[model samples]
Target: MPFAELDQPGDDRGELVGLLKRLGLRTLGDFAALAERDVAGRFPNDTIIAHRLVRGLSHRPPLRRALPPELAVTERFEYPLQRLDEAAFIAKALGERFFTGLALHSLACTRLAIHALTEAGEERVRVWRCAEPLTASATADRVRWQCEGWLARPDDRPTAGIVQLRLEPEEVIGGQSLQLQLDSIGHDVDAAQRAARACVRIQGLLGPDAVLMPVLDGGRGPGERVRLVPWGEPREATQEDQPWPGRLPTPSPALVPRQRQPVQVRDAVGDVVCCNDRGELSYPPAVVVVGDRPARRVIGWAGPWVYRDSAFAKQRHGRIQVSLEADEPNAGEVALLLNGAVGERPNWHVEGIYD
Candidate 1:
């Protein structure tokens, strides 16, 4: 809304009164009923004056004229400002004012507000929150950049141009004379602000969804266990209700899926031995050969294991046969001995490392 629009009697004043009523304050008498000092203490600045008007006091001295010794400054522009650059210039001037004021009072403003008087007379405001109060020039520069950014967007423009710019100190804290700590914090804050600004710029150039982060999900299978979400959104915590069947307490470092290999078996008499897919040696004197190297001897072996191939959708059949052994050339090593039809070479593959 424009500042000028605010001046028309029925427009702004009625709206403001309506807002006060929404806040449970109705009628001029309701505001007048409160003490002036109490009103100022509770609401501060123009808010108190606005309430006073509701109580029927039209003439009140501007609060700026009576402000205490603290770093604060305000500037009013005569001509309406249509461009962001012009507004930034005014902001810079206001910053200078604040610094000058602080210098006089021997204090600085840690937080400030850059307020705009829309051509329609309505106020549009932006705040500059700093980790600490800063020197006048630095404060002014920051305010200028902030105002420039706020006004840069076409949607931010008031129906009317902005006519006045003001910078006011909302809070103040003592600054160090040496400034070593202040400089460190300032660098960190400046870096963070710059990064935020860059992110905004990138989002503007690319659609918001163009940037994203990966989200981890709790599930037994690979495909069911991962997801993606917006970069800024918090990651979802692991679900407590769901149980993971056959999941290990400690996960394997390498989880890549590998192709299965087959192994050959022969009896002590060199007669070929055959086991059904269930991994049992058909004859008791069977010796395993891994890549043409005969086993030193047949030691204790675990099973002709059967695994369903249905878990891997891309494979033609879900049938898989495996064998486990405790004694082999690689003692204490877990070897995956596989089975295959004749004419197809048998294969042996190591699947894991156990300490």
Candidate 2:
């Protein structure tokens, strides 16, 4: 139940969840730890339920209804799945098909039951509970994580290949609340407009900063580019289009640390990498070590770019992009943003991580 999954809350869906996820919420504990008032200040819409759900409280039956048996979708694999990854791959398609069926009925499900049949004639089952309707992709991921957890027990691992999988909708509600309804036909609520009104109401209650929203601003750094302002205000950027000479090139980092972590950048000869008075490197960066993380070889890089309006600025720093073997949860090529003062001292810090 991470913040990303918060949007998949049994009765919630909107840009609010996305915002929190981007703010570095990694698990249910992270969001649940926040004060309800702080969350309400940003979302304004019914975040009370999200706070309750994150704290493991159930408002389930109050917002959801019983689903019909027709919403279940099953699939028999042509190739039996011996590993959890194979089962996970098949679940993705099954989830999409299942939700498609639900959509036809103008319904969405909050609780789901996953059933599996093995070639040895054994059966496995588990139920997934969400405070809100989950997207098809989220449903598939939940099943995959469940399977991985179950399969992780060496002694309890399935003895035979899985031949069939079934997804059943145990609880459901009208599909209307999951996304903005723009159809001009019926009495469907305009979700976007309602969210705006909620923001206004919250601002009136908590004062102007009660509901702030993010707007992109002109800056060379990804962290500086994001600006949170009071909601319902004009977010005009007069200089975003202006060229920033030393800005780190796109695409931007996916994760920016709340605080910059001290790091060591080394050269080919094992000497610490440092910049000269002219902001040029003493030697090209060849390796990087952030905090206590394993050293990563710098295979590719850009910059040593400086940030200052004038050469004499005391608060100036240089930025660099280094591509290395990923040290992240998911194994992919990672690019790091590093910052250092514009001087001979070899101090450096990790500015961002591209996942």
Candidate 3:
């Protein structure tokens, strides 16, 4: 974050934050990148706190490594859950364990992803984004509510007994940071909860499908990574959790076209660049042409990452990130996400754009 946007209390008081900015340390990452000892040498007055912050470590008791913002607490049922009311009973015990685990690490959950599995191999996953850090009672309440809601929907209820339940913390904050929503200085603390309540009310007025939330699912192609689910329904994601080859990393394109536009990548010899079944690029991309427009020079590129479904599957899907020289007719930097499909030739398409 920017120097002015540091969440620390004294950071806004204009001494340390300003000093860091003057030294060209604009972001939190910039400070964290330097060695903790270097930061201590720079700020001798606040050596302890500054050094700790420089390492991106929290103020909690020291550990082998910094506590991660999120974690998962899983429970396997010896006696599978067959009845709907039984979930409430399970929730109490599970919530206690969940809270205790978070307490041990001095962390609190802001967003929670609940995963439930049934004896018949059915899996249901839902994520709840909360405005406040959830307590043990609140966690149990949410579990009971979610299970009750799913049971009320005949189509969504599990066919077999639930054998496993997992609570994955999606977003977390410091355990010591809990404060009153309406403080002396006016702030919109209830905004998130208000918005959630509004969605629930809308679902009541209309149908469950009235509102939808987008989830970043796992897939090789940019278009396949986004999965939209009904407002309160459990997100269904099979291609999300598993570690698969050719999956693109973070800094995904901000905008993705609904349909993949035909595009062509070529080498300096004007021959089409191809990705083989094993994902080896025939040649470095020199030019990229979207439709019949003027061919743009390839300045930067990455991948031709390939995804193989299984041993029996013959198809090989691949993707490449290509940065093209922008023309006067186009906007600033032109970066395109290209996808190659299975066939005799590399049929490229504009999967998305990093404008």
Per-candidate alpha-carbon RMSD to the true structure:
17.9, 23.6, 19.3
Model 3, range 1-355, lDDT digits (tens) per residue?
Answer: 6656554674543677777778888777787787766665666645446546556677543567766544687889988887768988998889888988898888888788778888889998767766568888767767666666655667667888888989988777889855554453476646855676667545433445778888777876667788888775556676777776667766788789987688988999988888877668889999998998988999999987787656577777788999987677666768888888644478898878885
Task: Provide the overall lDDT of each model, using Cα atoms, as 2-decimal numbers.
Answer: 0.53, 0.75, 0.76
Runs in model 3 lying further than 4 Å from the true structure: 1-187, 233-241, 309-312, 342-344
Q: Name the candidate that leads on TM-score.
A: 3
Output the better candidate (2/3) by TM-score. 3
Model 1, residue 227: what's the lDDT? Answer: 66
Candidate numbers sorted by lDDT from highest down = 3, 2, 1
Clashes of 3: 0
Query: What C-alpha lDDT does candidate 1 achieve relative to the native structure?
Result: 0.53
lDDT of 1 by residue, 1-355 (tens): 2222223564345555555567675545665677888877866465665655555566575466664664445566678777767856776677777777766666666556667777787886655444445666667566656555545666654677776777778766654441555457646766865664454334333433545555667654333355665433446756524776423223331332354333455566876654444444555534665554546345544433333234553312111222335555566644332333322222333332223
- Model 2's alpha-carbon lDDT is 0.75
Error of 1 at 39 (Å): 36
Query: What's the CA error at residue 264 for candidate 2, in Å?
Result: 0.8
TM-score of 3: 0.46
Backbone collisions counted per model: 15, 6, 0
